[model samples]
Target chain A: MTTETKPGVREVQADDIAAKVAELCQTATHVLPEDVVAGLKRAEQTEKSPLGKQVLIEILENVDIAKREMIPLCQDTGTTVVMVDIGQDVHIVGGDLHEAINRGVSKGYTEGYLRASMVAHPFSSRVNTKDNTPAVVHTEIVPGDEFRITVVPKGGGCENMSRLQIMLPSRGKEGITEVVLRTIEESGGNPCPPLVVGVGVGGSSEYCMLLAKKAITRPVGQQSDDPETAEFERELLTKVNALGVGPQAVGGSNTAIAVNIETYPTHITSLPVAVNLQCHSARSKSATL
Target chain B: MPIVKKDGETRATPPFTDEDIAQLRAGDHVRFYGTIYTARDAAHRRMVQALQERKPLPMDIRGQIIYYVGPTPARPGRVIGSAGPTTSMRLDPFTPALLEQGLKVIIGKGGRGSVVKKALQDNKAVYLLAIGGAGALLSGTIKSMDVIAYEDLGTESIKKLEVEGFPAIVACDMYGGDLLLAGKEAYRDQPALGDYVSVPPAEKAG
Candidate 1:
């Protein structure tokens, strides 16, 4: 085949990535998303326990305060997680993509006055990374020349509550339901309820978790396009709410405002599932360049 | 409501005497004024290590409340950045030791472990809840901030905070009353008393 340049291909400077990533991080931390705000408002109206209602009310106030003042919704500004969808036709110039993203994270955290929560080592030392560099990046190449980035600052509390498991093929839908419910029950209020539970089924173990994490990046009430998956989400949500974990786990009916499920094809021999919980804050933002 | 400087107000700040803690119930709303200390996982690790070596803690923690927070840095003209409570469970390992040091109160979000609960009872201490994710709102209540120790740890460093109308609710009280548990149980036992319109039989029994 003869080599020829495509006419529609575009060049994107790495500086552009850094600048946009910084803004995305800053925006995600300072403002709770609109869907989440609406969800909390509805919870406040329907919350059954007086204390639970009061907690919901305070949470809404917190959102308002964070937005009006341009400060983070939570002190734990969280680990900077960036998801990049780079069009295959776009050529990124000026610098390495990962380095540019990290620089952007540092700039965002510093300029926005957000907390730096990352630690260097896991088992030993556990020193702070200072500027919150080296963000976790997940990238996908798609058909067009457009570049998109989604920034999710995931807090330690709810991130710690995330779980993964390999189940026997026999443990299908009912088994999945059992495990999901049990996870929320065991989680209680520690993940900072009311939680948004994200579940990923099938795929390899690692991809399963990635799916689960990505599920939370979607807006709070958005459900799967598949009818079967949406029904399952509704059922799991009902059972989770039935746990009585309530707002901040203090008790009421809103243990979980939503259950989101994402599925992928997997090897016949392997049945993997991952459950990731997003706390009430549920902060994320996205931009296309 | 505006919290005034009064002796019997439930929302009063510390230095809380044993009498003050005794009067508190699991669900009572309180507003903390005066000074409270800040620390999270890293600072707690260091403090617990200091305890092991029999070294004095960075500050006098006796009869004081330690808030689990690693705040965002303050911008220009701000006392502190978004300052809200972190999850308290991560500090569970060090809590009993701090309780032994006469730490009278712990403030953060979410529930504590059984060991911490036992420690609170033994130390005549209480664990309170600041609404999680309300950092910007809560930071409005802070009047001043000062880092006291572990400065290199950045956000995890030990700092002191002075707050006004710093709202909190009693989650676990000195008398072994756990509001989180009570709150869950109350709703489970009698659905009518809670905000839920209905409860399944399985959960009601469990």
Candidate 2:
């Protein structure tokens, strides 16, 4: 079943998308991304405190065990977050797109034996969804004929530490730095440092949060495209490490491995900043189909 | 049983006596070889509720260690999947009551609040820090696991686990020594912010 018969159009089966998402879910959970692994290795070398260094070593060992044993690096396995970029020239056929994604999430989580962490009613009974369904999917329409999907299984601990604040325009970069530092300081060991701090600036409160989430999905240590933003990322990274939260917050110089900042134009009277932290596991994977 | 210290590391099995806990100090690395019970937020809430309602708890938690973990489903032939500690501070609200019921050891990641710390000292219990996110490695330490109660909560179910050489650090000891705070204080650099920074003795001479 094809949606479009026009020239220059590519028809992608929704079932195929589900299969890819399912595969990605398992792989992302079992394997730590190379960039994050490298960041941890670097942290292990630079960490000062004995306990902090030992924690980094154990984390690296855990990464190895998960990869070798084909198991999740962390038990939380987390709420599956799917980011999809659909080309205008590409048509999804055979099923509803959102349902297809959720199907993939459920199948991957259940079949792969990952934890079912999502709860049905957050503020009520809080029953477990049982299959880790209803993934948070963000979709974008791009200019090409390619459909790309990125799966991020975000854990509860670090996600709980994320924060967003809408400040007066008068509070500029210094204010943003203060918020980020304070968040990191307050978080301490809970988020499982050394962390990858994602900073989103300039959008609305919600969009800023999304941007911060997107920033963390980028490869660790990859600077922003904007020159000024890249500089800001460096500055924030220096300040964050200076906090001496170190690996697992046992205390040393390696508090955060990277600070990725994403910014957009915002209203004149508002300065919205969101800080989303990714723990040491930092699991994420992508596929283009 | 009392804790045995050898080569600067403490080793112990469960059913910890007050003497065993008193032997532990903040920052002491411990390796356990015995039984532990697993429970997190949901199970803790129910247990606390049971206590409040004057109903008996499903399991005998006295002199027991509670590991705050909800592991993934184990694959065929495996004892458990990646099983690691969740954040402990989330269970801070329900902790004191558990301590009151003779809960001796709490194992998880991160620090606890002041009230929980005070409770730990008052009850002569200890808080141990398991390496967070090291689930796969931690799972290797579990020799076996069984659902003891609250099976309906799925992974949040209370499970009794037999473990061997399970490693952890004493984050908060019975004497009120707190490793998380002590670690940060020892390594934290002088504040860069003028308002928070103290004038160093060397800098004052300038």
Candidate 3:
């Protein structure tokens, strides 16, 4: 099909994108978003265990220290994840979109003093990708002429706990809830609770996992817009808190500050559920151009 | 309880006495002073391999504390990047071997496996939890650091770090006192604020 030039589709250089991603990665790792900081403060106030409270307090103080000193919030610095919403009308100029994103990752990690966590091969060599390059990128075509990008720096400790399972439709909500709870229970204090649990329900297995990941990047404590989904989220949250897993898995009442659920249409016979938990850090940021 | 401030002289380190570790209990806040070595997955594996091969390990393992961390690169004038604990569980398989070599103390985040806990008991060691996400604040406590071995591993290299007032909590004590479990049990009966679910009826209830 012959393409027609649009009257107003903006042209954005790939280098600009690389620079932005680099900056965003650094910012996301170093700075705790205000919402996450608030969630932690709330956890501190409500935690019943004295030790858990102390931990929360220290975490908040750490945030302040990291901000003032321009240090990363956590040592892991995390695997760089980029989610781009490309404007369908706009044409990206200069270089390959994906390569540009990777370049940005390389610059961000190296200059930001972020840890290079990526291993070259999963099973064999396992060499470090020194500059933390090859970001995991997810893209979507959206309506506007503006390009939007979000960078989520996920800590390895928490990411290791993420789980996905295919459930028979017969299992339904209870099964989904059970898996989510089981994942958290298995996680214990490992993922650094007062966690943000992002659950993906329906869709295909891979897609559901993606949804779970995307859900974690949402603002902590924000719930689903769908009333039923929102209610389910609250119910699951209550049960998870009831697990008494508490902050840092150190135990207390405030195990998780929020549970965000996202759903998509799926095969009629399958219920693919994925649980992605974010530690108290829950670092992420978005920029639009 | 507010964090118990542990400072000069009280901080645990090399030359750890039973008295030093005995003074600690699960849930107690500690400010680690003196020196600790940094090691994580790769370093642990190498250490274990050296033990199996009966080869000399990089550093003397006796009465030493190891921090499970792979820190970001140091920026200009900074001692290190955000240096926080990685999950300890990944180091579980190699831990017992290290403990056998007289590894006395461990610092990291998360629950350790039962096998490692058994090792802690066998070796009379303790495990402490640094505030997991508080790398920035914790970085302040680090006075100096130098990679002593396995520099090729990059961030995962074993390094010698001297820290002052490095705050942490005694997660697992020498007597098998597990703070992670104890902390959970501390509030097991209590419902946190916003916990709307009521406990299920007791099984004995008619």
Candidate 4:
């Protein structure tokens, strides 16, 4: 294919994208982001139960060991979720975008010695896809000439605990709080605490779920830019901690480190909400090409 | 001998007797030594199926401990990699049956269901909680590993593991004490919100 001659257009090689993605997958699984580490430290200080404090200490130690030894932070290394924001002015040369991403995922998991958690058949055979291929990739076209890819390796334990609901608009903030609290309580110790909860409000069902997932990709302590949303996040975080599901659900005052909320305008009759609970590992990495 | 310390941390080896299990209480810390078996969702399902068909199990599980984990592939010159616990509740259905067969201890992350708790109480077994997501640190405790059965299952295969100073907490004991419930009760700043709020089912779009 001939290269486009448009001015200010960036031509990026598909192979370079694959290489960067491969490096990111390995690095992200090995080292947690700094913000999450800080959150865990804060949890250790704030935890009321002695046992909970010990658990947080161990968790922090584990994080350090994982980074030092270059091993995965968690055994569930998880399903690779790749989110790409491609600039409309950039041209991807040499291969299909998705194929390159999957190639990168396969290379990263196999060469890095990460677990192959993906199974080929969900219902019947449930066979393991040994290489952990065909990552769940989401792509969006944006205004700039920059291409950004964020890889989130979501573990099944916490991902399974996530929930979404279409609520009556009348339920409002109280209803949303109740749903978030119920998810955390019912989840108990399964999702691993201290959790970073992501809440999505006021969109269609599927869109809200996406929003919740995106909310988690944001840094742990950063709040919503909107003041009202930030207040809601703080309020939800308080009630969730009050549930006393504590670190590892052994009960403590620091059940969750942060609550992040994202909202979108929706139909008058529906108030769709989704809660995505992230374990203490909370691993994600992004790179721009 | 059960090595119960004043600090609530106990050190014990597997092939534990009822006396050893009896000495443990919910919320106490434990450091395990010697051999343990690794199993998770797939391995448990197959073991339960074997019991149903009246076939001999791949190994003698009597008086043994099962750790719910699926570790990453070990790199060159390593015995294991990131060996942390998976959630235990998924094995709840298969656990009671194993406990009935003389399985003495279960090691994993998270809480067990009522049926499993009753089984532990009746069978004098116990459940231990390992640190979830703390895989690398836990890997340091494991000295060696060998796959004994169902190698084709990849990471889900049944393996024999030799560990030293493997840390965990007593989550459920034979005396009906559950740390998950008790700990949460102690730390809760306010009463629970009673029943969960019910949301109406979504309407099908035309």
Candidate 5:
């Protein structure tokens, strides 16, 4: 389908994308990404105890070692999550969209030395999907002809503690707070602290879950630009750290690094919420095509 | 509890005195003083079944800390590869029963259930949470590892691991200050005030 583009916008190339995706995959595991490293540095400086600061330093050093030595950041390696934003006019000429994404993930993980962590089932056998296939692809058709892709590696630890709730429409912010607090409180140290909590508000059940997951993919310390939503992030961040699930939850003071909140115009009848926790490794990054 | 040794064993068991444990605190890098035994979901099943039949355990539990790990097969001449802790929550069901047989220490990553916590307290034992993903760093602490039973369990089999002062963090101690709880409390910078998690130690690891 032909679509409009801005004056400077150009079509995204397949080879460029393949090379870029490979680099993004390798970079995702090897480096902490600028934002996350900065976040850790800030946490280190402001960290209260000598131990928590040391943990943060070790985390920083680990990131450095992976980058320098070209090793997978964590052994878990994580399942590949690809977020694609297709501009109004860009197209993939050589192959099917699904195949292209899968091909990229396969090459990236295999060549990058990352582990394969996908499974084929939900409740029953829970067999390993083997190749970490069928990447969790989120595509958006947006304003210009330039495409962008953000790949996130979601480790099993924090992902296990994720939760979604269908709240009474009347429940609102108070309900959101309760769900968030109870989830972290119950999680204790299982998710592996210090944690970054991502909250999804005002969508149907599934999308709310998606929002929660996407919220985590956002860079640390950046708040939702919407004033109301950003305020919610601040309020949530304060409350979570107050619970004291400090660094590694062995305890000191940095329970949660930040809380990112995203909301959508939802059905008047729905007040769904989802909480997706990201462990300290917090590996994610993006590239525009 | 009587000491039990398997037919193929080639190592001696080393017990730690109360002074040994007292000298250590949360987040200390001590090579584990005693020989640690390996068991995870699969091996625990056999242990439980052996108990039900009133059969002698293939390995003794006295003063032993059973580590919940299924290490990646050692590469070439390596003693162990990336040996880090897995979530202990999965083994929570089998913990108390094992504790009754004198399992004094449980080493793994992540927290355990209330049942396991109470059992540790009741037995005057402890639970240690090692750095979860520092598998390469942790494997370096082990002096040696040898398989003892259920060789067919693959990576999940029972094995006796000979270790020196292994780096470990006391997650839940005998009197019950769960480092998990204290760790959470100490580092939570901007927590919502009502949240009760607190860190136990104010100093960083040396």
Candidate 6:
């Protein structure tokens, strides 16, 4: 391999990553972006039920409280997760990326009053991380000095309902629609209706998961740039709302406010799609620096 | 789905005894009227531990129904804040223990898991599922939490509530009957006209 060095590139320290993570945790939890707030307000208008309408209003108020007090919106607090998109021009210095992330998560959770939801093991002796350390960190190296960090806290209910599946290409649009509709129907009002439906399409298993999650950050009602995929998302949206799962599934109308789909080209032999359901709580915040 | 106000008059299931478990069937539209306790995952654990140790329970669970809920903390002078049923699956492991201590009814959103269904069958208990995510509306049914145990656990702490006409659906009955399956079966592409065998209350008591 040629050891070609690009001049003037800066190296980032593990401490820098840690500090950034910590700050992100608190800031994201406190301030919801203007786009999201606007989307929720629009959703408040669209929700039909008297109870559902009231819950949406309370959510708006809760965000106001969370921002004003710099505390978490819900008691569930949530598991700490950091998604970092780093510039290729920079090199990390001082320590491991993972450790820096964990440290930042540790400091942030402790100082922010967010709950520590991580467990040492999945099966036996489920233990709390206390300070919500050891976050689920995802890193991607891309183009400029700007590193973007999105700190999202997902509660267990919506997390439990997330699903991924592989389908025969022959099933095509119709089959995929069925799977997605069935998933939401079976989910009922449990995922906290009027949810942002994140659909990941045309990837191997893991890529589908990444796409599904990353899809959330796109502004609440925006569509995929790909026309064909955007059309598919629109189709899924129509079918899902038709189920009348309503807000909280008590029944009325409008189970999901919107369905967003993100897809990529894949091998002819394989077709995979995943769905990640996010509740109205949709606690997420990001910083670009 | 029709809307019913809090103070509206309707058919209700008054507090019943252990023997009354045999008289309710799954899928029965129910409106619970009485004092019901609220306990979710953590409180359920503490309650079961108390029962296992033969220690005094925080409240009298005999013939009492527990609403699996962890409500948002009540604001000052407002009886209670958003209170709604959480998923029932999380409390399945602790159910049998509480049932052994005479726990008769468990209410929540989702249907009970296998162990909870088994416990309900063996203990002659019933499971009622409230509407999920209707927190604000559900809270209106609860007058107040008369007593709260384990204050430090915050929302998950045990709460003794006096409710009047809390609406819910009978999800699972004691005689191995299930309503979740029935409802889905009855609902179809054209508006379901499906049928399923159910052990009616009269058949159950006999």
Best by DockQ: 4
The deviation in Å at residue B206 for candidate 4 is 45
Instruction: Give the docking tier of candidate 6.
Output: incorrect
A166-191 in candidate 5: lDDT tens per residue? Answer: 98889989999999989988887677
- The TM-score of candidate 3 is 0.93
**Deviation (Å) of A228 in candidate 5:** 2.3
Candidate by candidate, in order, the iRMS in Å equals 9.3, 12.3, 10.6, 9.5, 9.8, 16.7
Residue-level lDDT of model 2, residues A120-207, one tens digit each, is 9989977778899889999999999999999999999999999999999898999999999999999999998888898999888899
Q: How high is the CA lDDT of each candidate model?
A: 0.84, 0.88, 0.83, 0.88, 0.71, 0.68
Judged by DockQ cut-offs, the docking class of candidate 2 is acceptable
Better of 1 and 2 by lDDT: 2
Give per-residue CA lDDT, model 2, range B50-94, as digits (tens).
999999998888888999999999999999999999999899999
Q: Which is better, 2 or 6, measured by lDDT?
A: 2
Candidate 4, A63-142: lDDT as tens digits: 99999998799999999999999999989998989989998999999999999998898998877888888799989999
For candidate 1, write residues B1-206 as lDDT tens digits.
Answer: 22233453466667766766777778878888899999988899899999999999999998898999888899899999998888888889989999998888789988899999988888788999988888999999999999999998888889999998898888998889998888887665222111222112121000
Scoring model 1 with DockQ, what do you get?
0.35
Error of 5 at A21 (Å): 4.7
- The alpha-carbon deviation from the true structure for residue A213 of candidate 2, after best TM-score superposition, in angstroms, is 0.5
Better of 1 and 4 by lDDT: 4
Compose the digit string of candidate 6's lDDT tens values, residues A1-289: 3334468676676787789788877676556656556656765676554444554665676567556644355545456767888897777777888888888888887766555667677788765456766677789998886666778877666677888889898888887787788888878646766567888888788999888887765666566677677677666765676575554454434556557788888779877988888776666767665
DockQ-based class of model 5 = acceptable
Give the 10-residue window scoring lowest on summed lDDT in candidate 2 chain B.
B197-206
User: Which CAPRI level is candidate 1?
Assistant: acceptable
Cα error of candidate 2 at position A209, Å? 0.9
**Chain A superposition TM-score, candidate 1:** 0.97
Model 3 chain B scores worst on lDDT over the 10 consecutive residues at B197-206
* Candidate 4 clash figure, as a count: 0
